[model samples]
Target: MSMPQPERLHLDSDAATGYPNSPLPVLVYRQVLDISNAEERADAFESMFKRHGWPPAWRYHLYDFDHFHSTAHEALGIFRGQARARLGGPNGQELMLYPGDVLVLPAGVGHASLEADDDFCMVGAYPPDQKPEIERGDPAQLAAAKARVAAVALPEDSPAGGSLAELWREDS
Candidate 1:
């Protein structure tokens, strides 16, 4: 089967939220899941990420307020239900994600769950051996967050397994 092309968005820094969104664009892949069972879907997504060098995948619901990871990039794959999320800080764009959707968040990009159904669940992963440092719109961490974001290395490819290297390389 052919992979769906991802929708890309580039977010700017929000001074008020103190979020320095990445220069790398966030990539969203829609309808990527083949399994109907939530647990199975999560397992498949986690395996995919692990195969592609992203490890330590976890499954959970997203938080309902603005937050970001300053230390590492993240990939989230929706396994069940639907949700509306705000990306790129408080002033960021709101996007609706459903089961079978995948979102790739670069380091320093902000994200929060605005709303979701009771069954909402997703599988999240980071690059191999990397642990994400959570930052919640703190002005005190702005400078260091920005620096960490700027210094983060790009992933070799997309978590969904495609030509993200070229996509991200050109964007970077």
Candidate 2:
């Protein structure tokens, strides 16, 4: 079966909070995996990431408050339950994500879980050999974070599957 294409969204910086959301568009791929079992879904996601040369995939629940990663881009594959998450920044959009949903967050994009089912969980990954630095809407880190976000390179492909280079290369 062919993979479903992802929906792309580009978010701008939060002027009021100085949240440096990413210039690269966020990619949301819905129902990419057909598995219903959480463990099976997680394993599939990990394998896909590994195939794409992304490493150190981890499984966890999302944080409740808004936060951004300044050092590296991240990808999350929903393995169980459902979640309502806010992305971009404080004033950004809210998205309802379910099992089999995948989100590719560019570096410096803010994300937080507003609500979720008790069993909500996801598998997260980063580009090969890169580490993520968590920043929680810090005013002091705004300038440097924005600079780092601006300088960060795009990933070669979507964590879910398929080329993301073209989508990310477009001017936002």
Candidate 3:
């Protein structure tokens, strides 16, 4: 088998180029269950969503053995213990996600990680309505946002480029 390449730069908003333009593009997220006995995990997972205002309306998938790259947006959350994502090579980028830690997926982003050291669970956050795709920014930009903007929006799907549109954003 040929070696998979490590993309030094993650492609996020660029995925839109592959699809026909849309007024409102579909955004995606996921809810990961704790790694435990299947039956118990399933039950608890169901209950957790209920506590939220959610009604199990969205489509989703469960991962058991094989790691899959989602066509949909993905973020990481840990339910039980420490969870770490190992980027295939020395790409100098690895998301060190912990319990309650959230990793937002940009438009065309992909990820793969080894098994969890403890039970891992997370609820991925994405917009149901059309939203501008967003990705992690460079050091200067990230620092500036934290310093200045109460909240900054990164445009990916929206009909804008390079930055967030404050008027277009909703309450987080």
Give Cα-based local distance difference scores for all models: 0.86, 0.85, 0.32
The true-versus-predicted C-alpha distance at residue 170 of model 2, in Å, is: 2.7
Candidate with top lDDT is 1
Model 1 lDDT vs. the true structure? 0.86
Reference-based TM-score, model 1? 0.94
Which ranges in model 2 have alpha carbons more than 4 Å from their true place?
A: none
In terms of lDDT, the poorest run of 10 residues in model 2 is 163-172
What CA root-mean-square deviation does each model show from the true structure?
1.5, 1.4, 14.3
- Residue pairs in steric clash, candidate 2? none
lDDT-better candidate, 1 vs 2: 1
Q: What is the lDDT of candidate 2?
A: 0.85
Query: Where in model 3 is the C-alpha error above 4 Å?
Result: 1-71, 87-92, 129-172
lDDT of 3 by residue, 105-166 (tens): 43333244555554555544333332323223333343332332223233343111111233
Clashing pairs in 3: 79-121, 132-158, 133-157, 153-164
Distance from true position, residue 171, model 1, in Å? 4.1
